[model samples]
Target chain A: MAVLNMVSALNQAFGGEMERDPSVVVLGEDVGRDGGVFRVTEGLLDRFGADRVVDTPLAEMAIAGMAVGMALNGLRPVAEIQFMGFSYLTLSTMISHASRMRNRTRSGMHVPMVMRMPYGAGVKALEHHSESMEALFVQVPGLKVVVPSTPREAKGLLISSIRDPDPVVFLEPTRSYRLMKEEVEEESFTIPLGEARQVREGDDITVVGWGAMMPLIEKAVGSVGKKGIECDVLDLRTLSPMDSTAVLSSVRKTGRCVIVQEAPRNCGVAAELIARINEGALLSLEAPVERVTAPDIVVPLPQGEGHYYITPGRIENAIERVANF
Target chain B: MLIDDYDPLKKRMLQVLDQEGKVVNPSLEPVLDPDVLMRAYRTMVLARQIDDKAVILQRQGRLGAYPPNRGQEAASLGPAMAIGKDDWLVWAFRELAGLLWKGLDPLRLYLYWMGNEEGSHYPPGLKVLPAVIPVGSQLPIAVGMAYASMIRREGTVTLSYCGDGATSAGDFHEALNSAGTFRTPNVFVIQNNQWAISMPRNRQTAAPTLAQKAVAYGFPGIMVDGNDVLAMYMATQEAVGRARRGEGPTLIEAYTYRMGNHTTSDDAKKYRLEEELKEWEKRDPLVRLKAYLMNRGMLDERQEETILGEAKEETERIVVEAERFPRPTVDDVFKHTYAQMPRTLTEQLERCRRLEGGGR
Candidate 1:
């Protein structure tokens, strides 16, 4: 196993997949000689040649739409959206064609491709660089949403998404791109989608979180342990096909649940999780499921973001509210 | 039929059987062998039977609503025979006869009208896309396929078949513009059957002729007597060969008529004249083809009876098979939504299943 950060792991995954299948091609702004804005595709152009590792124009629509047409012709395209904010422009093409091709054609055609975008707050970047908008895609019927919190999961899940026979939106939380690191395999491998990873096990209560909030949940879980509260922590790696079974089972055992997400509270993934548990494990619950999420507002500047976003202290307090209820 | 002195266009257009019975063409005469002629007649007969059965099934509440191709059989089959089996054919809703020419199972088409998504699934390498309902959307897709073929240096050509109303759509312009710029291997066939539902051709466009619109797109445009099977086949063959030889796309406007209501739900009597129906009745494509064959001493009354008898029996067998085909499950509706089912829909499916006591 080799220890690598998110950028390095992504580079290895791209290199491995491109070598494994010549059909795989990467296209985005500055992904060639510049190796992408974040260097995630570093040295890929030299290894795979410029034809396959394309440095496309700075047009997100062209990058995404052309990938759709290319995928329709039997090529596996991995397009980079650079940032979540810039990804909004690609939504129309994705929803109109890529998502509905199978249904509209009555399963006569399939789009095998992936749209990779980096998103999250707390990176102290420019405007549109950090925005958590995975929830926007959650409502789309045919799109699978995957958010990896760790480098190991990033490479594996990305490979799996690329190889999968459908279109996928892979959101990489930029805050954790360098902050979180783990040992990953040199050989190519894939992690099955729609499955959750149990980060920690306990019996008193359950803490469910995903993406950029995983580390904060970890910290809160440790602090709550000092208060003698045994908490089960689950990292929901996949958002679209949420692990309802694992979540409900954990809530049933603890008789309580606290959900965490970086998106706004009103209509975020946490809201959906709470509704699922309320509907499924109503008898098993000792109290209402609590959600520790960002308020319904635009992600604030780095200085005041601590108040608007979910933090370790806020999660700790929410966990206590459910435990003491 | 009105057998009298008329204009040359009308005289050349309103044909019923040659003096013999086989269909004939003037501009480019194609030698039709016994086998080819039988195949063409069989496909035409099968297409009509399928359209008739489908409309009745819809009326009887057995199949979903559909657009019927009652009078334009040769407009679809004539060109369908011009292309190779491996060539791609992108269709709008009114080209049911083209499916038979592409060797699609009649039962599968019936299943589709029965509301099963699986109805559009053709065999591997058949190169036929499912029916496109949004009118001209398939035009750009056909252009894209042709462009890709050009990039790969493949000899394949794409043929797009649509109706007169589709010419008004923006997608049609995009496709034509792209084909013009790239000079891609493609043939655009417009089945101008006079009316788009209740709206007539004059309402759909102000242009003198639909074929003439192709000149702006840098392609030759030809108006054929759609009711004349020989003229349509010869015209399409010339255009298709031109495309295959890298000359670029051509627009073929087959001038035909809609003999019946647009679909079962429509009542042509509400908007059309009873006298107009009689006028087009004299130009029946099938009758003209039979007369042409008879004029060439190729067919007789006994052969016509045998052919129609075989076509009817085959249609009956297909109708029985289509009726016997099993229904798809509710879960099957959720399946194949994507290459793999999305998680959001999976949960929705589970909720529905749990409510239905976990059933099909």
Candidate 2:
């Protein structure tokens, strides 16, 4: 086991996959010499050379479309959109083509590619840089949206995402990239998408989080656990093909639920999760599922993000209210 | 052969053969073996016939909405012929001529307009992507494929076809920029058909020529008389060769005109002038190519009739085959999102199946 953060774990996953599959190629702005904006792809250029490790221009749409084409023509390309904020231009290609390639073609042709971008707020980033648009892509036809909560899960899920015979929008948590280190497996392993990782077990309530919100949910769990509140903390590894069984089973056992998200509250992934829970385990629930999410407004500047970002206190409070209800 | 100092704003349109059925620049003309020349002419004839048949199909309510590629046969087929079998065709809307030239089953294209997902399906190793509906979107994907080809040392060139209007898209700029910056194997042939739906070419860009925009991306951007099949073919061949030798990408703006409405849904007569349409009709791709071939003694009246007859026969047969394709199931909509249908889709598929009277 190696103590690694999300960035290193992601880099290791890239290296491991590239080594395992020659068809795997990495492309993005500064992915080669600059080693990515946060060094997430550090030292890959030297190891793999210019061919495998491509440094693309400031073109997110090209990054995505090009990756899809590469996937179309045998190469399994891993494209990096420097930040999730600039992903709007690329979304047309992703949703219209990459996401719909498999279903639209229906002739066994699929885009076996991964578009990796660091998402979310709390690191005091710029306007577009702090967005969490997981909910937007979930509705896309053939896309699998994966967001890892920790370094270990990041490595495992990425391996699986790369290997999966479909397009995946792998959202990396910018705040969590170097936030902390965890014991990650040295050998490459794919933690299949659509499977939930229940970080902590409890019988009273079910707590869910993903990406940057996982740490907040974990902190809230810690805060509540100290006061004798037992809960099952589940890290939703993949949001598209959600781990409904894990969520439904946990909600059934716990009888109370709370979903945390960095995106807007109106139509967040939390809302979808709540809908699924209501449909699948409504009778088993003792109380209504509470959602701790950002307001349905555009993300504020660094000055006001501290108030808008989901905190452990809010999650803890929501848990207590739901647990007591 | 790479135009090292191409000025995008210049009005330097490359024309190998003039409309008078004469080779204006014999030195620039490719060594057109009789067989290759005949095939090129045949493909153009087929393209026009297929497009004309589609317009009829649309009127008869047999086909869905179609953007007819009536006057732009040369622009597509020329470049489509230039690239090798290994290269990929990242096509935009209205590129049936190119797809057919590249061996995409003509019936599948007709099936595509008939609202079948299977229409986008190409045989393995065909390397032709599904027709991108969104304008200018496929350009970047072509760059990416070329990027992959270069990285793998596969020596494959990617020829992306788009209309004159696609040049204004940010992805178009991005695609050109990356290909220029990376020195990847890419050739973008913008069919400057003078109109992007209702918006004319002048409204699309302030730049004098669409090809000049390629200069901004640090690459050669050449404007070719798109109606001149030989000129377009020569330009694309040069571009393909440059890309294979790791020289760089080229943007060939095929200056042509769209002789039809944007689609079955659009009323072109309401916006476009009849005079402009008539003037462009004189430089028709098929007529020019046929006349040039006849003057060169490669095609006579009998051969011309045979070609037209064959294209008509093929178009009629493809329409019959296209209509025979079974209707797609509602269940197919839920599948193909992932490798195996995920748990959510699995449940949804079951629901849809039940709705379709599966009973279980």
Candidate 3:
């Protein structure tokens, strides 16, 4: 085991995959000589050479569209979008074509590629640098969306996403990139998509969240527990193929559920989980699933985000409301 | 030999076998082996049969819609037959004939016109991409594939087929520019069949000729009579040879006329004059080919009738076989999106299946 922060873990995973497969390539702005803005690809260009660690022009659509063609031909491209906010330029190819290529072609082909972007707002960044728009990708077909909360899981999930025989949108929590360090496996492994990790077990209520909100949910669970309220906490590792079984099981066990997210509330994954709960576990004898989410507004700057965003206190309050109901 | 010195763009549309079925330039004539010529004829006949079957099927309510290639058989089949099977092909909507020339199955062709997505699925190693419905979109993809092949030293050339209207798209320019800059092995064939649905050629492009557009991309461009199968075949063969020899890309403008309505759903009477349509009918590829074969003492009236009758029978058999394959399930649409279903898609699959009574 090695103690690695999220950024270092990403560097290791990229280097490891490149070493394992000669066809695996990393392409994006400043990904070559500069080793990326966050150093997520540090030392990769030096190790793999410029061909494999391509420093492409500042064109997201070409970067993504060209990757689609590469994946279709033979290479497994791992593209970096710098930030989740910049992904809008690439979504036409991603959503209209990449997502529908397999379906439109009737299983004739696959786009086995991964796009990694840092997401969420909390670390006091400028405008458009931080956004949690995982739900937008969730709406598209033929694409898988992943959001990992920790260093250990981040490396493993990324490796799996690259190996997936379809296009994957891997969302990295920018706020948690270097916020903490944890011991991760030295050898590469894949944490299967669509599975959730139970961070804490309780009997009173279930707290579900993913990406940047996972740590906050865990902290809220502990705070609620100190008040004699036992709360279950689940970290949804994959947002698109959400671990519905894990979520519903936790909801069924506690008879109360509160879904939290950093993205705006309306039409978010939280709303999706609420609908699934009503459809799958209606007889589980629980109150309506509450959602602790950001308001339906654009991600504000760091100064205003503190006022608008949900915190552990906010999550803890939502747990109380759901448990009392 | 002077044969190797002939350029499709600089020289006259080279025709070794004259329209009267006589060897006009016997020395310049290609030494096409007997098997290759037969194969070319078979593919051309197959393409026509498929188009005729699609048209009748749409009228009978057996197919949802069809973009028939009735008047453009020679334009597609000629170039498709000129290339090797391992070479790559990217096609637009009206090029089923080209697909058939590259060994695409008749059953799948029927399935495609019947509105099933699975019909476009080519088997592995065939190197033919699925049909691109958004016209001209496949050009960039073809260029990308050619670039990859060049980088890997695969020695494979890619042929991208599109209509004259496709030349007006930004993607076409991007693909041509990138391919030229990289000197990738690619051939862009513009089947300028005179009409793009209801829009005439004059309205579609200001350039005097589609082939001239290739000059801007730093490549030689040629204009050949699309109805002359032999001319189209010879020009394509030269282009493919150049690409394989690392000479980079070429743009070929097959100047022909659309002899039918744009598609089964189209009404050409709303756009073009009856006199213009009648003029193109005289230049039909099948009529020209039949006349040539008759003059060569290779085909008689009796043989021609037999050929037409067998073509109709073969098409009916294929349609019957195609419609028998089970309709694609909704789950099939979600499969292969990724090798395995991702968690998010699994949830969607479950929801859809549940709504459909858990059948799929």
Candidate 4:
């Protein structure tokens, strides 16, 4: 084990996978020589050469569409979309082709590729930079949406995603890239998708979140714990094909739930979780579930980011309210 | 090189056989085997018959809305004939002739129009992608496939088809630009069939010729008389040879006409003139090819009758077989979504099965 940041851990994942599998190729704008916009693919071009680590033309749709073709032709391609905001350009190909290739051809073809992008607010970046749009991808069928909160999860889940036989949208948390350090295993390891990890076990209430919101949820749990309010915190690693069993069981045990998200509130993943809880664990609930999310509005520019960004204070308040109720 | 000689910017169009079915460019004419020529002619005829029957089927409520490939048979089949067996063919929805030449069973095409998913399950080693409905979306996919071939040193080229209107889409430019940058073995054939639904070619772009667009992408582009099968075949052959030799991509603009409605659901008479249809009818690709074959004594009137009669019988058999194909089951809907269906999907499928009265 070695202590590393999310960027280093992910770079190790890419390097390890490419070295192990000759069929794995990396392609995106500036992914070759420049490593990546975030340097997550640093040193791959030199290590794997240009054929395996390609710097594509500055067209998101082509990058994604070409990745689909490459995947169909027996290449495991991991394409980066620079940023989540720029990823919408690839939705045309993702929704029309990559998401349906296997179903349309009835198993004759499948897109075994990954589209990686840095998402979420609180980075105070420029317009179209910090976007938490995981909900958009989660709603798309035939796609696996994985968001890794820590260095270990990022490396493990990404390797598993690259190996899976379906297209995966791996959204990296921009705020968590270099925020904290952790001791991550250097060797290849896979955290199976559709399984949630229980960060803290408690009986007062169940606090559910993922991606960039995990840090805030932990902070809220810490502050509420000081107030003698112990909470159960669950980090949902994969959004699509969600680990509903974990969430339902946790809610049933605690008899109270509070879902938090960095994305806007309307029709978000939190809403889906609440509906599922109502379906399976409603009779066990002691109070109505509470949701803490950013309002349904455009993520503001740098100066106004703090106003729209979800804070730990808001999460703590929601957690305490559910705990008391 | 045919591509360099008939540059679109120079307003030069390549033509081996003129409108009268006479060899106008003997030096550029390809010396194809007699059997190959006969097969090419037969495939074009069969494609036309299928189009006609498909239109009637749609009208008779036996098939869904179908697109007609009336006058653009040579524009599609000629390039298909030039493609090697290992080459990939990525087609837009209206390339019936090319699909037939690539060995796709007519029953599958009929089943596709009859609203069945199994129709897209092409046999192994056919090297053809299912029809892409969105305009210009398949271009980038072809480029990617070609790129993969180049990386793997597969020594295989990719041929893709689109109509004139697809040139207006951003994906067209992006795909060609990438193909040129990477110099992948790709041949982009644009069947400039004169109409995109009701919109005419003149309204689609301000460029004098659609083929000139390839110039901006740093590749050779040429226009051909799409009604002349010899020119289409010759141009594509040269382009395919260039790609195989690692000389990069080539763009061929097949200047043809849509001799039928855009689809069975469309009515060309609503916006087009009768005189225009008459002018195009005289230049039908099948007629031109047949006249040339007859002049060379390779095909006779009686032989032509036999070919048509055989195609009609085969098409009837294909229709019966396609209609009798098994319907999709509930499991099929959930099976291929993922390599292994998730528990949620399996549960949903089970619920659907129970709802359908197959309780277990």
TM-scores of chain A across the candidates, in order, are 0.98, 0.98, 0.98, 0.99
Q: Where does candidate 3 clash, by residue pair? A: A240-B344, A241-B343, A241-B344
Model number with the top DockQ: 4
* Ranking of candidates on lDDT, top first: 4, 2, 3, 1
Q: What TM-score, to 2 decimals, does candidate 3 have?
A: 0.87
- Name the candidate that leads on TM-score: 4
The residue ranges of model 4 lying beyond 4 angstroms of the native Cα positions read: B358-360
| Docking quality (DockQ) for each candidate | 0.20, 0.75, 0.38, 0.80
Cα lDDT tens digits, model 4, A115-168, are 999998898888999899999999988999999999999999999999999999
Count of steric clashes across candidates, in order = 20, 3, 3, 0
Question: Measured by TM-score, how close is model 2 to the native structure?
Answer: 0.96
Highest-lDDT candidate: 4
**CA error at residue A307 for candidate 1, angstroms:** 9.0
Per-residue lDDT for B1-360 in model 2, tens only? Answer: 535433456577788889877999678878979999999999988989999999999999999999999999998989998988889888898777788889988898899899988887778888888888788888888887888788778888999998888888887888888889889899999999999999999999888898888878887889888999898898899999999999889999999999999998999999989999999999998889988899989999998899899999999999999999887877666665666888788888888788779575
Error of 3 at B140 (Å): 3.5
How well does candidate 4 score on lDDT at residue B177? 97
Q: Residues A1-325, candidate 2, lDDT per residue (tens digit)? A: 8999999999999889888888998988999999999898899899888888888777788888889888987899899999888888788999888988887778457899999999998989877889988888888878889999889999999999999888999999999999999999899998978898989999999999888888888888988999999989899889988888999999989999999888999888898899999899999999999999999888899999988988889999999999999
Q: Which tens-of-lDDT digit does each residue in B266-345 have in candidate 1?
A: 89899999999898887776777777666666778998888888777877887788778777776877886876665557
Q: Per-residue error at B326 for model 3, in Å?
A: 3.3
Q: Model 4's DockQ? A: 0.80
Cα lDDT, all candidates: 0.80, 0.88, 0.81, 0.92
How far off is residue A310 in model 2, in Å? 2.1
